[model samples]
Target: MSNDEDWYQRYLDMQNEYDYENTTDASYVQSKPVQLCSKESLNNFGATIIPVFYYVNFLLSYLGNGLVLFIIYKYEELKSVTNIFLLNLVLSNILFASSLPFWATYHMSEWIFGLALCKIVSSAYFIGFYSSILFLTLMTFDRYLAVVHAVAAAKSRKRAYAIIASMVVWCISIIASIKELVLKNVSENQFSGLMCDESGYPDSTMARWRLVTYYQQFLLFFLLPLFMVMYCYISITIRILSTRMKEKCRAIKLIFVIIFTFFACWTPYNIVILLRAIQISNPGEGVSMCSEEESLDYALYMTRNIAYLYCCISPVFYTFVGKKFQSHFRRLMAKNIPCLKRHVSLNSQSTRTTSQKTPHSTYEY
Candidate 1:
């Protein structure tokens, strides 16, 4: 029995030694490093988190943006040069938010929708994103010209000019998004399922493409737009302070809030992508030591979700904050929604009846 136990222990030792030798062989050692940012992390973080965010933003944006669209469409009085910009802004947000479900599904499972939709959905997202910034910038500029050169703007800022500007903005947005239509497709890896991502090109080309697009979005969408908005608003603020236009307080406050919200959501997202672009440039080993790249992955993940939320809140800035829009919204809400109308009518009736029942109540009941 003792001799058998010693022999079994020696056999186990020999097996462990042989296994270690095989593991350290040239072929095994030379194998490419595993991509940490791929399936496992996405399955854990993205699939669990992104769909909820996508759906929440989708519902909020659809209702808010859709309400703005409805108000503009139903009421002729709601239409104006600034309101036209708001209309386009709401439209683009709705168009963008409509694609959220697909992205959510893409992250969770296969891109079962296919290649054509991948292109359309992907391109539409960018078109919506760029158009959003464009309209917001134009809105700021319109306000700037209106406040600074009121009489001149009144003469120049016609409905025709707004329509032409809307067309131009849409055209530019579409032009910028054409690359997504060409590049975005269903991913081929079985493990990743059918992902609708930019996987049609080689690694080198994809890296270059990502870098170019990152810089483009950073410069055009974020930085330049940020500078322009801040400049216009700061100039407007100075002008207002120098003059006696106290009624401009509400508008300026809303503008400040809008700019702050935009930056809060997008600045981190852009910074994360810029870090990713920088990491991509470093190739392999040297870049991996930045706290295991998980922090970068998580940041990119979280910031993207934050960015999508802006569409949901934009209508709050554009419509709900405006007195005209509120009155119109209230009227429209009272008119179309029977339950709301009934509630309001009942409340009014009860108030009138109570007034009539009171001693000093000769007021119309």
Candidate 2:
């Protein structure tokens, strides 16, 4: 056998024969030594990239979502069924961003916060992350019903219904995150030191659990919801074009913006993890090249930074693109940035009409 194949074979043999109970060092059989990121590389990569991204995301997400919450609280018009969903979306972002400081510190230093805090923070992060996606899905459905089946939607629409839906989404997300809440703890990484990493060894059972969760995340968070969003948006587009619902044009634009932003921020990260999942699922083998493994490690690090940046991006999108949001935000800014209020006119930006506009009309949502 060639040297490469022989080396790979031996690595696999070692992995299969490894006894975690006896071993002091938790070494997995990987073909590429570089795949196990070195301490200097990790410090340079993790400390610099992750903390910068996390802190930026945290600050912007907090400010943006906080502003949305304030707008909802201060304005009478922001209480519509659709806006209620938007309110919940902002809340999800805030909740998600709140977990960032812990993670930022975790990535930069050791897991000094102990096991219980690790579990709580991880649970909060998962709940916030998943719930944002769920609420977005709900918003799409609300739009679909409002535009495609206006009268029927109106008959069914209640402020109470939106509240109930928001509660259900949050409840489901929290329940789904319970496993992570239980599993997460402060553990020692050979390279990264005592950190809030997964405590499990890379054994068969953990591998299976990882596979299941990976599939669950891909389907629930990415594939299925993406398909649903596409269908809803497309149907809404067709109806709007046929009826020339010009006011609904902004709503359609918002949908496109949201879908594009979501995929842009999340697709590469999800794809990288999915590849890792496939590797994990069928891992009696080793990678062929050190550079290949290094590339993948870099890819994961970069893509995760991109995904985390989404929490920051979301609030900006709502603030800039959602005309109603812009109007209210300007009003808030005007109070402080006093000279800027001269040109502000919310009446023109208002989506409400004598008939309350289409249910899915801009900000009518």
Candidate 3:
């Protein structure tokens, strides 16, 4: 056999023989190398680093998503048309972020949790991630409708529709992710640590499914939303420049920023995944499959981390952008505040006295 075929054969054999075992469990296999052939290049680095990355991501994502939920819940005024989108975004992020711990543990040890959790939790990860993307896409469309087609949007921006759409998005996400249950089975690698990926090593079907998912996300979540957002922003910019409504202009700018942030963080991951799909389809034609997998895996992880930043930074946008949410927030704050209430009462009393002291002018007739 040629050297290339030999290398590929060795890689294939490595895949079949690799054992991932729980060090604590005596039953765990410890016959093969601790790492996969795919990750051979990173063999110099300790496996412990992976867990550390996961833990840090878990902490940041949990705190950020929690705070976003709090901000929306605490301030009633944030429940405007704009914030409806934000609320969905936060909910999706929170659920998605919760999966980090499970992944972190899975990386460190065997799938001791069992098949049910292995299937369900991993599926939940996809659901959360996909749902977030859908919600962001919805938000972009919502913004476009309000800014570009205001009159039509005013009539159609019903809370009922938003609720219905969110429900649909989630339902679809759950259904799409459910397939993971059937696809993933428990397996022990060379290290004897149980892992939960596709049963067959380097399964092309699994790669195709992953590629399809990425493509769907790109078309539905990124491209469509990007087009609409760009159109809306361009139109909004022209309108703002021609008009004198400073507050409205600022609101449009803020919405643009939010859209830009999503696009910036997620675009790299999407492009990389698509390219990965291409490389997978035409393998051994100069593309290093092992290196591609490692790079794509790292890129996916980093992209997810960057995307979570939006969850943390978005509260600031809500506070600063969208005059309506801010107005509502201020009114809610004013009402809840004792000092502001007292001050307002005193101001009202002074106003009454001044009115009583003043004489009516002939113009009153």
Candidate 4:
């Protein structure tokens, strides 16, 4: 009996030794350091490229939109609802363009403007972005009314109505951007020094805030407005096609251009924003993959730059395309610029002659 007891004790000791060895090996594997993903190359690329593009955009947007404002103020009586909407659109573009320089500086260096300026700049930027989209939607609706429901539009599209609509759009834009005003501040980054971004919260809280804002922009600014603009343009196209108006083909072409431009400018940015929102929501799969996150960062930057070009292009599409505006601009320049007087007079005479030949043709809007 004593010999059997001793053998059993030895077997139990061997089992314990095996279990301890397995535990020690498992902990050793778990304790190894994780390799962190570095974004230094991406940051350097952005610092090199973003400032240049932003400065160019700022210059072009201000010049184009400012010229539109000057032409409209000098010539238009502000009675046309379309002109009123165009004024608001140009103003929105200017407001948006005003923030580009600050952002350019931010990209080149740290946010040296402090927390107050950061909030103001961020809020203004978002307000201008939101207002510009809203105004475009309103303008499309105005066109839809003019083409699809001409008689009713003639009755309802008054200067008062346009003023009220402008006010409402501005209010909505401010409200939508209130988040930026509330949340934006200068946060310290170890690699980048100070950054003007959302902070003062836990990582989880910041992620949630970002997710909410991204979806808000995606849904309200991009998706909803896109649907509205598409519907308006489609209705306008169908109405123009069914009619026998002499300018129907020209009108259809303009509608196609507007829709195409809108999609080309905004779709990629919004799609990337939606992806970012999804990645934020699904941390286990999306956040764990550093390669995917870095790719998304690159995508977001490129797409946003594409979207920024619209501020410069909007003036050409909305204002300069109109013959009336061109005439006004020529006359304004001729009056102010001595060298162009002779050319302007000749062009004016030629335009008048062309107008006389086509009495039924209206100014392109």
Query: What tens-digit string does per-residue lDDT give for candidate 2 at 261-307?
Result: 87788889889878878767654323454344556678888887787
For 1-365, candidate 1 gives per-residue lDDT tens digits of: 59999999999999999999999897878776655443486467888898899999999998888878887887745347987888889888888888989998887777899899999999988998889878888887887788767778979999998999999999999998989988887777868767788876899999898898888888888898889888887887776657644345655676678778888988999998888888778755534554546677888888987887875667667667654555566668778897798766665565556444544211110
In model 2, pairs of residues that clash are 82-365, 83-365
**By the lDDT metric, which is better: model 2 or model 4?**
4
lDDT of 4 by residue, 1-365 (tens): 59899999999999999888887795656865455778898899789899998899899998888888888877777888988999899888888889999999998888999889999999889888889889989988988887788878879989999999999999999998898877787989899999999877788888888988899889999999999999998997887667656566776788788899999999999999999999888743334667888899999989998888885668667776666777888998999999999999899888777666653343244
Q: Rank order by TM-score, top first?
A: 4, 2, 1, 3
Highest-scoring model, lDDT: 4
lDDT of every predicted structure (CA atoms)? 0.78, 0.75, 0.64, 0.85
Worst 10 residues of 1 by lDDT: 356-365
lDDT agreement of model 4 with the native: 0.85
- Candidate 2 yields a Cα-based lDDT of 0.75
TM-score of 1: 0.80
Candidate 4 TM-score, C-alpha based: 0.86
In candidate 4, list every pair of residues with a backbone clash.
none
| Cα lDDT tens digits for candidate 3, 1-365 | 99999999999887666643344445564543343345643432224655666667567766655655665677655445656767777777777767767876776666788878888778878787778767766775776576557778879888877878888889977886877777878888896478877676466678777777767767776677667666766666665555545244454566567667767876776677677667667754223556666777667666656665554344444444443344444555567796676665565565456445534210010
TM-score of each: 0.80, 0.80, 0.70, 0.86
Which parts of model 2 have CA positions greater than 4 angstroms off? 1-40, 77-79, 189-191, 200-202, 246-254, 284-293, 346-365
